[model samples]
Target: MEKYHIKLTEEEAGLLSKIDLRSYHQNHEEGRAAYLNNQEPILALLKSLSGRRAVPEVRLSYWNDPNYRSGRIKGSRKGLFERNGCTGSDIYTHPHFLEQLRYFLFGTELPDAVIEAFEAKVGNPEWVSSSDIVPIGKAARDLTRRYRLDIAAAPEEFFKLCLDMGLGLSAAESVMRSVKQVR
Candidate 1:
């Protein structure tokens, strides 16, 4: 495998730079909303390149549903819905997406054994544990950092990484292209 030094295009760098760690705890609602809205331009750019790839479907049945948010923080609930809905993070990070991305980028899909190895390397006890991969807290920060670096390094590699990470390929490609064009 070729080791490509991924550099973020100016737009990607700008986007990554906008992410503030404080938003994770202080103004989660605002942060989520902002992230959700930002997806629009990125998605548009991806569509231009990949021509309408399948958009990840996010289940929003719990957003306004009182039954779901009863115990959850009131302000955070809606924000969660918007962010998950817009970015399709709920779906993108699923194993299926990871497999698709791996296939697209490396021309080799991750087998079950490989996945097990990866989980071991990451030291995640519950590989698919919802609690372990809480999107509201640490996951968000980690994603922000990872994405920023990926976009900054190699747009193509970052696109491939997104796919491998279960984010839709077209969407990733589009965002990368936008970053490239801006730079």
Candidate 2:
């Protein structure tokens, strides 16, 4: 796999945390156009990478999520559940937001209908039904692990990887310099 060093000032890193792509995802509920409009920054950033190499494989994990392993996905009043693959908190904030960001940036092989179902809060009575919803945990895990994710080539990708690596929003606290990818 190929990789590139990412250089970002503190300002850029903070932007990652500020980006709110998950709020409209079945949270408050917004039309597709409105949802995309609210998240223009994320879309613009992704568009900027149009000709660049696709995002490198990411090492997102589900820990030892027995539920994820057992293929038991749940949809409750709180939100969907699949072991550590996701939580109500994650869906509302942080790492899950990060994951959502990854989803938009990298795109998915999942059918457009599946993506639309996830993006919209209405329709799809299946949205509230666990049995009908595609198991996102397994799909996300499998998509993320397709390649040995050894490096990141973009600042956005790097920031996300930092959080995925458990550096959290304060990844700057530990590595104040830019990300460097090795050949």
Candidate 3:
């Protein structure tokens, strides 16, 4: 896998934590209200620093379905006790908002090295299981720990590296920001 070094300062880490706190609030009714109330100032700060929008609505209904694995939403077996009625629409219900949010938060462009690393990790059986289909989440976490200590690259660079190593984009971004302060 392609390797890049990255580091984060204390202030940057704090800012990323605040962003995560807001995101957590966005999931529930009360949290959503708090998130909405604080949206402008957070957006202003994120915009000034990264020139991108940070408040993106994310629906996690698919995550609630027990039968759902990886990105696939499988129909429950007839005899199964836990029947999941989740459909494809439930998984991809809000594509437009997701796309827009991703673009706004993380730029449209991914670095070439990052893409190469992703291709390498994703195609390997060691990284992706055939029966389960869930990519090895632990491996991705380990890679983040391995790379975050290097002082050569910026937090965003480390974030991209985490994504390339099989971490979800939002998760990787969160981790990247968590390690450093962003103001």
Candidate 4:
């Protein structure tokens, strides 16, 4: 229910775009590690979350998407389908990463295998077969209705909200300021 606006030039926005996002998500760990590594600002903010609980929920919005209301999730090769609460885009959270949050923030560490075990139990929801994510048009509408989102966010502001979670004043102002410079 919390919202932040992040702005990016066409270039940084490229980093935030579905293209690089797909690239970052393709291999999951290594891909994101590589992606964030290249993106120094995002990496710094990610590290800043050490020992913190209740990190912000990362939900992306396709502001320019118009086909948001059909409620039909499309598979890359196939037309539309629904599995569980998920529609498409195999966005599985890295349990090890989340476990770190629990460990740092709550002082409890879950076994590395827990995430996989949970996935195995719940069944993984694979996205449309192709790596190309055809813009999350279907779910965007639902997301819009459910969450109060800003028109858009400045990349730095988005990262701050990502780190601070709108809980209070973010402590990462310097980091955010540096990010603006990079952009």
Give stretches of model 1 more than 4 Å off. Answer: 1-25, 51-183
lDDT against the true structure, each candidate: 0.36, 0.35, 0.38, 0.29
**Clashes per candidate, residues 3 or more apart or on different chains:** 13, 0, 6, 9
Tens digits of per-residue lDDT for model 3, 1-183: 213222224554454445433224335677656544444434434444443322222212112322322224354222122244434323222222233223334432345544455456556423443332223333333444554434333454445444444545555545444444422
Clashing residue pairs found in predicted model 3? 11-181, 12-180, 12-181, 12-182, 13-180, 13-181
Provide the global lDDT of candidate 2 against the true structure: 0.35
**Cα miss at 75, model 4 (Å)?**
44
Mind sharing the TM-score for model 1? Answer: 0.21
TM-score of every model versus the real structure: 0.21, 0.23, 0.24, 0.17
Q: What TM-score does candidate 3 reach?
A: 0.24
Off by over 4 Å in 3: 1-9, 21-28, 37-41, 51-118, 121-183
lDDT string for model 2 (32-134, tens) is 5434443544444444433343333332222222221112564331234343465533343433344544443433323334334323422332333443223
- Tens digit of per-residue lDDT, candidate 1, span 1-183: 322112344554454344332224347577566556544444333233234332222112222333322234553344544555634544423222333333322332223343343334335333433343333223323333444433343444333333344443344444345444322
Encode model 4's per-residue lDDT on 76-171: one tens digit a residue. Answer: 211222223423222122222332222222221222242233223323233222221112222222232334333232223323322323211222
RMSD of each: 16.1, 19.1, 14.2, 20.6
